[model samples]
Target: MSAELYDFQDKIAKIPEQEKKAFVLYDVLGYKYKEIAKIMDIKVNSVGVYIHRARTIFFEENDDSSCRSRRPMMSMVWRLVA
Candidate 1:
């Protein structure tokens, strides 16, 4: 894996457990929202919300000074996972 993937994994470990699970299921594992929601026992919409929060938390936890105040764009977020 690349350094960015390492950083992403580290950052993911630091977020809330629910958000981490939600993000991983939907984004990394390619699970459907309904599937994730069923597994998590949350409403389907909450899956999307958790994913959004996860991405935000991922960028916020980074060491980069400029990104501290900025939420990462979805494109950049996917790049880390990709």
Candidate 2:
């Protein structure tokens, strides 16, 4: 794996458990919101909220102004997973 991908995963590993699980299920595992909601026992809408919050927190924590411009963290994550 690339260093950037590894760093992204490491950052994700450091997030709160709820957000981490939601992010992994939805983004990494390609699970639907309803399915994620069932797995998490949260409302369907809450699944979207969790994913959004997770992405925001990930970019905030991982942003590096020196190396590159800030881009959507999910885009990088998708490259890793795909």
Candidate 3:
């Protein structure tokens, strides 16, 4: 996916520069921990922390109550699943 498709754009923008770069490299670019470490000149564990924090922030921001209020688009699916 491209940068335009990122769900975490607003939250990610709020992250510190170092952590933001690490998150984009690992999460968006799909780089392995070791590769991200090499590219960013950081340790593998730091990469892990950045990715984790980024995900947490993204979900916390996006998962507001209104977003979770799913009105069933297809009543049949909700009836079957419910």
* Best lDDT among the predictions, by candidate number: 1
Find the 10 residues in a row with the least total lDDT in model 2.
Answer: 65-74
Q: What digit string (tens of lDDT, one per residue) describes model 2 on residues 7-74? A: 88777876788888887788667788999999999999999888777767776754563422223444
User: In candidate 1, what are the lDDT values of residues 1-82, reduced to their tens digit?
Assistant: 8887787678878779999898878766678899999999999999988887886787674556555322343455678666
Poorly placed runs, candidate 3 (over 4 Å): 1-8, 63-82
lDDT digits (tens) for residues 1-82 of candidate 3: 4443353355657777877777666655557889989998988998888876765655574555443221421232234345
Model 2 misplacement above 4 A: 61-82
- In lDDT terms, how accurate is model 3? 0.61
Measured against the true structure, the TM-scores of the candidates, in listed sequence, are 0.65, 0.66, 0.59
TM match of model 2 to true structure: 0.66
Error of 3 at 9 (Å): 3.5
- Candidate 1, which segments miss by more than 4 Å at Cα? 61-82
Count clashing residue pairs per candidate.
0, 0, 0
lDDT of 2 at 15: 79
Clashing pairs in 2: none
